[model samples]
Target: MRVVSLVPSLTEAIAVSAPGALAGVTDWCTHPAGLAGVVRIGGTKNPDTAAIAALRPDLVIANEEENRQPDLDALRAAGLQVLVTEIRTLDQAFAELDRVLAGCGVRSRPDWLDAAEAAWADVTPDGPPVTAVVPVWRRPWMVLGRDTFAGDLLARLGVRNLYAGHAERYPRIPLDELNAARPDLVVLPDEPYRFTRDDGPEAFPGAPAALVDGRHLTWYGPSLAEAPRSLARALRAARR
Candidate 1:
């Protein structure tokens, strides 16, 4: 079965589980190292529908949040079968991954998926929950708010998002307001915006900053298996 994946996480999952099944993928699908010889449709937000349709894929995988509706509509209007997934929590991610793989003709579950579930299942928080402000973007200062997959992941790891109750899933706040929140820790992921030690921590002043892998914190694929350990280590390192 030929597949075109618009979502990076889904692309990695499909590429790893069913090698060579993908005929096309977005330019953002950067995992599994050297992904060569595949058609690069475009970016997630602005995919080239005509280029994708020309690929004649049996399935096009996408996410509700990562992809735009008009693009999905354009693909469907061109007679392409697009599978759109919604994942706001860990459970949803696992289930959606199962569904996506099944749609890709993977009858048996991948070992990595099983291991990912097991990894999260064995998690035990080392101490009380740490209150943190998670910044996904820095220029305008957007943060993870309510009903976000990243926020849910952090919650499972015993880090409570200060903006988890905010009306917006990702709200842009002023710099002064963010510092005023006075979170115990500042969690920075290196994607959407790259927040390094020198770059991000200075703004938070007294708050310790945990610099983490954005893929582990955001992507819901094979990375999930190691996210628990890697994220825990980063969080622990910040305290040390």
Candidate 2:
């Protein structure tokens, strides 16, 4: 089954589980590196519908959060079948991954998916919950808020998002306000924005900074298998 994947995580999952199923992929689908012959269809928010349609894929994969509605509409209008996924938590991620893979004609569950489930199953909070501010972007400073997959992952790892109750899923809070929140830790991921020890930590003098891998913290695919352990190590190091 030929498919075009607009979601990065799904692209990696499909590439690893059902090889040669991807006819096209977005420019940002960077995991499982060396995607040699796959056609590049532009970014997730602004995929080239004409290019995607020309590929004649049996199915197109996307995420409600990462992809634009107008793009999905255009694809459907052109007689393409689009499978949009919404993942707000780890459970949803696993379920949606299964659905997307099945849509790609994968009859059996991939071993990576089973391993990811087992990995998360073994995770328990190492200690008392530590409140944190997880900034996804800088400039205007957008943070993970409300019911976000990243926030839920952090919560499971014993890190509570300071803005988890906010009305917006990703809220742009003023830098001053974020500092004023005085969270115990400042959790920074490398993508959506590249937050390094030098770039992100200086802003929050009051809280210790935990610089974690963006893929492990955000992407929900094969990386999920190692996220709990990788994130736990980063958090533990930050506290020390």
User: How large is the C-alpha RMSD of every model relative to the true structure?
Assistant: 0.8, 0.9
Instruction: For candidate 2, write residues 1-240 as lDDT tens digits.
Output: 999999998899999999999999999999889988999999999999999999999999999999999999999999999999999999999999999999999999999999999999999998898999999988888999999999989999999898999999999998778767888989999997999887555567768889999999999999999999999999999998
Across 161-187, the per-residue lDDT of candidate 1 in tens digits comes to: 999999999999888888688898999
The parts of candidate 2 lying over 4 Å away from their true place are none
TM-score, candidate number 2: 0.98
TM-score of each: 0.98, 0.98
| Candidate 1 deviation (Cα RMSD) | 0.8
Model 1 pairs in collision: none
Stretch of 10 with least lDDT, candidate 2:
198-207
